[model samples]
Target: MSATENGWQPAPDLPPPSSSVGIIGWIRQNLFSSPLNIFLTVVGLYIIYKAGVPILDWVFWSADFSGEDQSACTSGGACWVFVGQRLSFFIYGFYPESEYWRINVLFVLLAVLIIPQMIPAFPHKKWLGWFFLVGFPIVSYVLLLGGSFSLPHVETEKWGGLMLTLVISFVGIVFALPLGTLLALGRRSDMPVIRAICVGFIELWRGVPLISVLFMASVMLPLFLSEGAHFNKLLRALIGIVMFQSAYMAEVVRGGLQAIPKGQYEAAAALGLGYWRSMGLVILPQALKLVIPGIVNTFIALFKDTTLVLIIGLLDILASVQAAITDPAWSAVAAEGYVFTAVAFWIFCFGMSRYSQGLERRLDTGHKKR
Candidate 1:
């Protein structure tokens, strides 16, 4: 056996595997593996070149950025000048010019609080979370709607644009989440009365269109209330949006709750945890994490639906855009106005989507088979 007669010999050390394995292999496997794939890749490249080039030209090369009026748009391309002219209106609506600093401060405070909360690695998150949830809203309200401070009182009717849209969506989501979770739990309760009430509330709101709900809040709600009990229009709209969205959220949360295994509940109970403790400490955390995508989707939908407030005479971003384009100077450039509005909405919605994806990845505990 020691004789070199045995033909078995180690293969010569292959040259170190090529570094092309990183990107080149990936391209080969994904884009150019088969003849059909190669053809498709070429076709895709052609399509991109054809479509993307013109879009780039229009947005960058041909678009008008300067000048005060439509006459500045000489390039037979998009008249972005109109957007620039009415930018303030698009952002702040008819918010009083003198009080613009208050809005700016509110935005700064929001960013200061919210950015840290979104980042998981930030320290003292619990305290930050409490402040963001409990304190920020009070400060924001006082700043925006001043009656006590020497700051002049700006009527709710004066609130419009992106600010109003954000106010509605943010307040709606903040209130709806807890309410929805409770409704979901109640709907699954052992007690008949609580379950029945929860079921009815969810179904009633879910059955009606949001437009109808807003209409009821705007017109019918005022009629039902005592004449002396004057409700702010913005408050009425917020209530309607919260109620409408909470029903949808309850259903989404319920789906997540139902997806949990019975063993989880049994295990919690066996650990001597009472109902509230078991659900709050064990069940809800997992349930909510499991449905992060659904929850974020509901939030995105609610944000977009803020535009419907315009129907009730509340000027959200879309309403502000509409108002801006109504000016004869910018009427012809409605497309530009709408595109700006769409981009703004897209930024917020896309940010939410990316955050949800990151959260889902982080919370994934390998409970399910990959």
Candidate 2:
């Protein structure tokens, strides 16, 4: 039969590859497909030009870089000179000028510990927990706080800015997670007394405002302790944050534990595994895996919530930015200070969410056909 005869159709003509792909096609589809898109393209270009060109010119071409004072930044751009001059205080606060290397080393160690947990080929899961949760914290505390072992002492009061934010969030997570897990397990347990106590603790914390908790930690906590007992202000705040975060973490983990099927537990029991063994081996591994997204989300929230340290008179990164802006030298740059903080927070939170997505994809093999 002819190509166009006997119900046979001729091959449809194809567009040239260059026209069908790459920049021209992308522009046609995204920027000018409809009247609204065309309008948006024009509006977006105008906005970018208005905002971007001045910013780039001011920050790079017009702004000063090498001066110790805001006097060098005579133009209308970002006074990055202020940042450059005060970079040390921004990072280390009142930390001893000479001992800042301790903080840097501790940060490096944390990065080393965290990097392995992120990789798929790291050591066995149990060993990883032992190293991260048990070993690394001890080492990090000794290196950073430096009260014993002849390392120079840096008081927690001297901690400020981003370093303080990291310390608060890290300590909060480390202390809260195991406590949360135990609460979740107890909430699900058959022991009535334990279940009641766990429920009360979780509910009590969840019911109050975190700010109020911080206030109590700052003001009321000292009254509860012995008269002579001393607690660092930062330590008190960390305790409050952990207690508050643990309640939320408990709920997240509880959801995962409840979503688990009963048969999995029964099967573990049939295998003669005891309570902790069955939960640890057969149940929690699956449950925690299922809830990793939720756990990471809670963690991200806690990281942002560290900004609440401002109410307790601590200079976490957000408060530090506030302090930087209020300085008469940089008062005009409040917007920029906030924008910078938002950008830093966005980068960290966005990276965590992306990592969580990657983990979800990696662990999605259960539903695939063998």
Candidate 3:
């Protein structure tokens, strides 16, 4: 049927250009938009292929998983048997085998308390969060240290591996954030004495390396305590981590506080809000939102830095891995131990990073233009 001959010619429709739709279009626009980009993309893919393939091969394709010991790993692949055999030690350190149930109980309790707070549909999240932050530590202390209710007292020296790592990081994070916020506020106070005290504390702590601070806490801190006071190694390290990290956290928070516009303060004051109310109800929420990335970054660094506790005789997860590799039977499997340690750390840190990103997206508002 020839439309032209019918005197009612129909206009033809054509498909959109293949270069402007679908995955191919995305690749064209994002990866090959220019000649330089095309070159870089090609190079990047080549690099990934060269590095990733062998890593995957070593990790899974040729790796030993089901073996009970290193002898079972003879395929020239990663000897994951070493990690498997010592997995409990890596998790709970020298804590008594019979008490493994205690650690599991703590893990279950943590998830029960935390998951509800994360779910948006859950009610009274605020109260739960407060309880988790304040009460859970006490509960954990009783369970882990086991001094109360006739439970055998597990000394501080008995704690190590991932349990110790999590303890230090969690307590440091819980205490540091609030303390740091207060320090930031004090630093910005109108009273010169209060401001000077905060400035001194922040500068003093920030000036020293965390390594030195840890060393001091381990060796020298005991001299100043009252006579007969029993200060445990883990306790000292916890105190050091909090104070040291608080200094850095204060700065991160202060940067956020400064970014806030002056008009917000005036608005808070106009509503008859006092200083604490103004800061807590209005200023802090905005300031904290703006610096979510920095706060999370500090936390990530602190989590990794817990590895340094090995210096003061604390066998954190990395230290536990190091200990595992020292065994004569598993000496050749050091790489596997390290890879396991790395994967464990990466999982936790990546979770925190992603969660912080989601929080930032949820809180970030009003500043973007339409």
Each candidate's lDDT (Cα)?
0.89, 0.84, 0.89
Off by over 4 Å in 3: 1-11, 17-38, 259-274, 277-282, 285-293, 367-370
Candidate 1 — which pairs collide?
none
Instruction: Residues 1-370, candidate 1: write the lDDT tens digits.
Output: 8545697777678764564377877888889989999999999999989998888787788999999997899897788988888888877888899999999998998888878858899999778867876788888789888886898888889998999998999899888989999999999999999999999999999999999999999988889888799898999999999999999999999988987899999999999999999999999988987887889999999999999999999989999888888887654787788889999999999998888888778877877445
Task: Name the candidate that leads on TM-score.
Answer: 3
* Per-residue accuracy of model 3 over 1-370 as CA lDDT, tens digit each: 6777778766678777998899989999999999999999999999889998889999999988887776789888898888889999999999998888888999998889978855668999878978888889888989999978988888878888899998999899899999999999999999999999999999999999899999999988899898999788898999999999999999999998888888999999999999999999999988987887889889999999999999988989999999989988776878888889999999989987887777767767866233
Model 3, CA-based lDDT: 0.89
Q: After superposition, how far is residue 365 of candidate 3 from its true place, in Å?
A: 3.4
Predicted candidate 2 versus true structure: per-residue lDDT over 1-370, tens digit per residue: 6776788887889777775479988888888999999999999999999998887887678766767776776777677767666667777877888888888887787777777768888878568666877787787788778878888888778888778888888888888888899999999999999999999999999999999999999999999999899898888898899999999999998988887888898999999999999989998888888888888889999999999989889988888888887888665766667767787899889988988888878877573233
Whichever of 1 and 3 has more lDDT, that candidate is 3
Report lDDT (Cα) of residue 143, candidate 1. 86
Ranking by TM-score: 3, 2, 1
Q: Could you arrange the candidates by lDDT from highest to lowest?
A: 3, 1, 2
Where in model 1 is the C-alpha error above 4 Å? 1-35, 259-278, 289-293, 367-370
Better of 1 and 3 by TM-score: 3
